[model samples]
Target chain A: MTLEAGTTLPTQTFVVRRADLVRYAGASGDLNPIHWSDRVAMAVGLPGVIAHGMYTLALAARAVATWTDDAEVLELGAKFTAPVVVPDDDTGVSVEVAGEVASVEDGRATLRLTVTSEGQKVLGMPKAVVRA
Target chain B: MPVDASLVGRTYPPTRPYPVSEAKVRELAATTGADWDGGPVPPTFPILLAFEAMNAFLEAEGVELARIVHGDQKFRYERPLRVGDVLTAALTVASVRSIGGNDVIGTTSEVRDADGALVCATSATLVHRGGAA
Candidate 1:
């Protein structure tokens, strides 16, 4: 697919709840308490059970992968700016992801991702380079 | 607990070769909500290997894993990795600095194939909170 500079990709939304976090913990091998145990999270001075930063990263990556249609050949990066505090409610939090084609250079397109949760930006300076 | 400046630039030994499995990939995809579109392994899958190396680095340096928070992450792939590729990863402490009573550690882990060809590299910033008080 040909990507033009200044192209804005379709925005995607991902829902992350407690069960999803548990599954991700098992899959990713990151059994951090802050991601699962509210008591531990509180002890550690966190608001509550927060999703793993990597989990959030994974969500953003899915959007990029879906956009590029070739998740296999891409370089993705993100900065964890703010925590996505996941309350223990049945309805978890939703992360909205939108991307812009920052540039198309040398057969590679760099996408800048804006990831937000609860009306606040959760990731900063997120970027992905896809060989299209 | 500051990451000793001397630890910077130190590369650990290559990890045990891990053969990526399709079943594992499917499990990861199901859990992470990734579409099982039968493409290359997810770009974030290297974390399995990177985290292993990271635990080794922390243990060798006497850093408590419980006190650390992941600050950021990035992955650069020479090419996409696929299932059945036997891979190994070598980790290096790329940089380290302290800010506001916390230690920020920068790490880069090189994932290589059985033939030592580069596959993907993962870089992460770990923040070690200074104290409990």
Candidate 2:
């Protein structure tokens, strides 16, 4: 079954955890206090430690990878307009992705992915280019 | 508050080459939940290359690092990045402005392969969280 352009994939849910957030901070060398320090993040006006925008963007990329059998996920990008504040209560943040195949040709496809949390778009205007 | 708008249109030299390793890409993939064995680098992987160039340019300008927060980032690609791809990234200060106790800086970066073919173009916005409103 070949994935065609404009084909929308089912939404998958993911829990965004503080521990994962910390790992991302370390991996990306973006040790923003707001990503791990609940107290500091709160002091800075966030409800709690928020997941980095890139983390959410990564989830969108994951969807493309899964859809394309781990094909090259080229040029995924977005604007971080809002912070995803993860509360300390242990109910990790949830992200859902709905992807549309924008174009397909010669074993390569472009997917327009929309990632959301609590009904709000997390990775705004996300897109990916995948091979096969 | 004043922004050094003269910095706009200034193109910094290409940054030092960063060897793209599978291990680093795997780690980033795991962190972002992208497939580690995607056979090619994950999307957003170019950010590291672009950010490094941005960092050097900012340091050369004496910009206070501690005061800046990443606001937004976007990337467009001509093709996917693969292992063994040696690339050079250059940054240009696109715009700067003072906004409510912060300095909003915009920058653009172009990444090219060893063959001088454009691989990716990235744009970013950072908010310098200093100064009084």
Candidate 3:
């Protein structure tokens, strides 16, 4: 596939639930209570138990990998603009990721990504460069 | 106290090598909901090493894990990390700032192969609430 600038990759959304966070915490060894305990998260001034930033980042990573058909030599970056609050319900928050090729050069393609949850952007300055 | 700005630019010694095995990567994949066929690499997988390095950095700086909020994360790779490649990580504080009684610290972790070749660099920002309150 020839990726040119302004090519919009198919968008994807990922669900982040409490159970998913538990698995991520166990796998990533990031046992921060804000990801699991509502009381702690509230005490810390968050809306509620929130998803881990890395988890959200991973979702974006998946999008980039899917677009390029490879994950190697991919540079991914994002600033946490807001937390994706996961309520205690079975219907967890859905994170939407949309990417477009901003540029292609030297056999590399740079993708600009927008990540949103609940109609609010959660990741700022999101960008991914893949050696497609 | 605010994270000492002087800490910026100080790189810790490389940690002992960690063997990356298929089982370990698979375990991480199962946890993160990713399937592993061992092609290319998972973009966020290098964070496994970076997270370990961050732990050592927090310990050495006397920072409490419970007080931290990850604010940002970035990964730049020289190559894909494959199974069986033992790796080490060294962290360097990149910046520090204080806001509303919170200490925002920027850190960069360098992941190197057993031969000391750079494999990837993960940068992160950690916000510590009431650290200077």
Candidate 4:
């Protein structure tokens, strides 16, 4: 089925954990203490160590991919708005997605996405172009 | 102990070709909660291949991975990558400088296809924390 422009895809909700942050730090060659150590993070300028912006955006892309059954993601762009604080509580960090198909034709779809936390948009202008 | 300035402007030999795959792309897409439209590959996918190139460079330079930080990354693409494409990525030390007892290293990578056609250019800033003591 061809996705028409303005068609809203399924929303995805997930959390970020200290373990996942550490693993991403290793895999991506990013080891800033602010990403893994809450004490260090608080010592710096954050409430606590937060997930990498790319990591969070990566999950957002998964939302679009799952909707279309693993179609090719042509391009994606995002900007980090706020730190995803990893609290001591095991609840971790929650990410919610609200997006719609911006355009679609010939097995291709462009999605405009917004990611929020507690009514505040943390990731603004989330966009992706994909093809199946 | 700053990163060797002599490495600047030096272009390393291209690393072994890495093949792009559908399954890998799907995995990345799954991780991002993205929907693929069956079009071109995601822009960030090549970073997976580039990471290998970066690792080889670090190994050759004797740089410790634990001490490095990815300060920034930017990708400029001419076209999308497709599955089954055998691509080569060559890393070059573009610039370097010392900052507050640390070393900031800049690197550029050019990715090309088996036919030697340029596909994309990536620039990254690596902060060598505490290397310039």
Chain B TM-score, all predictions listed: 0.92, 0.90, 0.91, 0.91
Q: Which structure is stronger by DockQ: 1 or 3?
A: 1
- Candidate 3 lDDT over residue span B57-84, tens digit each: 8888887776788999999988888888
Candidate 4 lDDT at B116 equals: 95
Report model 4's interface C-alpha RMSD after superposition on the true interface residues: 4.6
Q: Please give the fraction of native interface contacts (Cα pairs under 8 Å between A and B) kept by each candidate.
A: 0.72, 0.61, 0.72, 0.10
Q: How does chain A of every candidate compare to the true chain A by TM-score?
A: 0.95, 0.88, 0.95, 0.89
Q: Which parts of model 3 are misplaced by more than 4 Å?
A: B131-133
Scored by lDDT, model 1 comes in at 0.85
Order of models, best DockQ first: 1, 3, 2, 4
Better of 3 and 4 by TM-score: 3
lDDT of 4 by residue, A7-119 (tens): 88778887766777776666555566777887766654467677776677667766775676656665566666666776666777778887888888776687889888766
DockQ of each candidate's interface versus the true one?
A: 0.73, 0.53, 0.70, 0.19
| lDDT, model 4, position A1 | 43
Clashes of each: 0, 1, 0, 24
lDDT tens string, model 3, A13-71?
Answer: 88888999988888888888999999988887788999988889888887777777763
Residue A30, candidate 2: Cα error in Å is 1.7
Which segments of candidate 2 are over 4 A away from where they belong? A88-90, A102-110, A130-132, B1-3, B62-67, B98-102, B114-116, B130-133
